[model samples]
Target: MFPFKMSEGNPNDGPTPQPANPTSPCPCRDDTKGTQRYETKEQEADSAQESCYSLFTVTQKRWIVFLVAAAGMFSPMSSFIYYPAINSIASGLNTSVELINLTITSYMAVSGVVPTVVGNAADGLGRRPIYILTMLIYLVANIGLALQNSFPALLVLRMVQSAGSSGTISLGYGVISDITTPAERGSYVGLLLLGPNVAPPLGPIVGGVVSSKLGKLLDSDYASVARTHGLEVNRVFGDDLRNFPIEKARLRSVFYIIMGASLSILAYGWLLCFHVHFSAPLVMQFIIGATSTAIFTILGALLTDINSSASSTAAASANVIRCALAATGLAVVETMVQKIGPGWCFTIFSGITAAMGPLLLLERERGLGWRNKIYQGNGGSG
Candidate 1:
């Protein structure tokens, strides 16, 4: 499979041999290929094998991975932790359960959007500064939540908490681009997500939300290879990031993943009918957690692979779509259950998810052609 085509060889493979004809003219300046103008996927793969460099020592990388993974615990922790207390919060605020659920909905909706600003800033600014800023916000939000009395205060504080936490996922991916090469990235990313995946089931019982810069080009072997390729580190793919079929490159690696997540969500929904059993729903939550984490982790890696540098912006774009869909689902789920009951309600959602399989098949077949046509329409800069 084309699978982002970033690299396909074993990690130990050597760099591509120097172009016999460096004087043969760079393919990059051509409107058709731009900087990503690889003569073949294997060539890019070889270059990747050669470029897998990192300044961090193995022990240091382990620490950094643990830190990023730990940061992932925040988003879900904030959400799941608050769920068990929903009733108590409603009682304290003298509000109905519906209004408290509105708070939940608001938290998720904000989670969907706040990443745009944080992630964009993380891309342009440095990941370290953004990380510190958001954590401070998270800290303050926690204090405010602890003191919150009114329903509005609770609502606002939850949103603030979401704002502080959600962007970390995007930034986590950006870091992945920095420390790991494509050949070994998937596993490292899985490690980075340990916090997120492990947090969900335990979160309601304890309650907590736990938990990016282009400077990366300076830190790893990618920088060396990018220099050799005559590509700009600031714009890794090129000036026009759209020149590559990025959607295809990313999704190409995760086709089965999309379907697997669909099945898991379907099962999760049906199990929600038995939420009173506690463990039953939590077990399904655990399964869905694993599947969803795989989807995010893989997609994040692919986005980093295709974009202009390994970017937080690219990763944030994926988060925007993912969180938005989730927020929409959360917003309407209660009404759907009341209207049609959980069985019919979730079956419809699952069906919608299943429908994507065929469409993705179509995307796999024609996405490149469609992108090419658009490329022509964009006057070759696409």
Candidate 2:
């Protein structure tokens, strides 16, 4: 409608030049509006650049995607990986666990802000440089963390570490968006999330091993220590879950998940405080890890059900809120433990978690069925 050519006018038509190749640059002027009609060669080439997925075969692409997702996980991994060393870190720094725990609050605070800036920069500067920059920041922070003996140094460096690490998962999502179509996006996202989901449990185990045997050996003999240590529900419901009542099927599961996770949290802190057994906390960590993963997965599905198109925004919003709450929780938890003692402090968190159950139940009662029906009627459109 904007621009059209007349059929090669009959033979009587004035002679016309051959049309230009679309790929080749051919600037044209519209004298009436004084506008240019073509782009430069470089711009055309940029427009023609291949997608991120085009460079690899199917198998290769999967591996690349998985690796990127795994790399993204390092940020979350760093958070928990240091957990087993919390007491050790406190003792080594000659600081209270309360003070050491504030590092977690600082970390989450910085994490909440870093990704917004990093994402905007990624849009402006490209992903590779930012990725490299963040990784260097994290690496340097870890080095400092290992060497520093003071609480303030620990606090400042953890923030720096989060600054470097938090945007990685967002970057992973960007990659999935670049390579995948909507039909396949859900699976890719699930796989990408696996990195974070699995890291919680494994982090503590690895952290424990490294800080204990490995750290001592490195400091002493330099050779004395060399050691290392190391989801099915969706299938049952499958696509059929979409046909069923979304709220009842999905959210009801969350009820159980929150219950289990809350209890695990309470138990973990109780066991540690009482010196029940070292393995007890580890076991609780594993349960919490698994339950938390399930909770997130289900919540994701619920959000998607509500509005698929806004799922990314929903996730980002949730992350920000979660980080903020985590910061608050972390800030208070240490002091709470000091004042009320660990047993009751954990009980309080357990109660907080239990509080969520009733809220979820309320949602289920209010309009869960109606909302699910609306979603279904809409053809699950985003």
Candidate 3:
């Protein structure tokens, strides 16, 4: 009798099986998903430990993403920051308004075209190096633009500026993907996008103020100086402060900011609901805008950290998605408000914003666990 009972007609009934050959590929092992097969559990554990130990901590990674988001802001802000200077530029260059307007066209064209090339380069060459190169190009272009005397110089320099600034947002997205995981990506992505969103409305206001304060410098020196200062500031934080814990440093401020934002949004909604003073709610609107701006920047950076392998393309895809959603939201918001009344409209939005809080927290917890697993080989380690 067989030591081990074998059922009649079973696959093993024909013969006693020999032990699996450790030197040969296991026939029973299905590797369709590309998971590496180790000879033993000990080998797998050692591999995981090595992989985890090489990665940067969550804090360090976030700081890098934050800098990328800051750099990314220059592109969208540049789009509208020049609006107040159009007429000034026309007069300064002794050119027609129509001719000067073509500068905008050229800038927009370069902005769209440059990102694809830069993003691809970033994917292949690495994020930090590509960012520095682009920024340098943008700085040089800005200086030339400030010194320009004719419409041709203005047009050419603007294109150069666009080429330099356009790819930054893409690079920021790539950096985010490098450090973050898919589970917590949404909130981080939302944070990173804040700059572009905030810039649109504030751009004109800032441009008008800057133009008024520095009328002579508007087309002569202000743009170059401002660009230079921004670059210097970014370099300090991005490069000089590389050793600081990024996620911890940045996120510590977020709780208070979010709390204040939530209260302001709620107050704004309540004021509208009760038909109270309009001006108070308007002030609250500004507060909400300011707080939300920071929130979005944080979220955007967090989103990209989850998927590092194809970060550049992911960033590009995200920008397209953001544009589409924003367009759709704008299209429907007015209709929704008209039907529901301003108070209810705001209340609905407030609820939506509030809902994001828990989701963010959940992602944060998951992200921390994921980071620990990646860097520590297990969640049990501190």
Q: What tens-digit string does per-residue lDDT give for candidate 2 at 112-136?
A: 8777677656655766787788889
Candidate 3 lDDT by residue in tens digits, 266-291 = 78877877888888887887778666
Winning model by lDDT: 1
Query: Per-residue lDDT of 295-347 in model 1, one digit per residue for the tens?
Result: 55555554665543536787777777887787778679999999987767877
Q: Which ten residues in a row have the lowest lDDT in candidate 2?
A: 222-231
Global lDDT of model 3:
0.62
Model 1 misplaced regions, further than 4 Å: 1-53, 202-287, 308-310, 338-341, 362-382
Candidate 3 residue 111 C-alpha distance from true site, Å: 1.6
TM-score, per-candidate, Cα-based: 0.64, 0.54, 0.48
Measure candidate 2: CA RMSD: 14.0
- Model 3 misplaced regions, further than 4 Å: 1-46, 197-308, 317-382
TM-score winner: 1
1 or 2: which has the higher lDDT?
1
Q: On a 0 to 1 TM-score scale, where does candidate 3 land against the true structure? A: 0.48
Higher-scoring candidate on TM-score, 1 or 3: 1
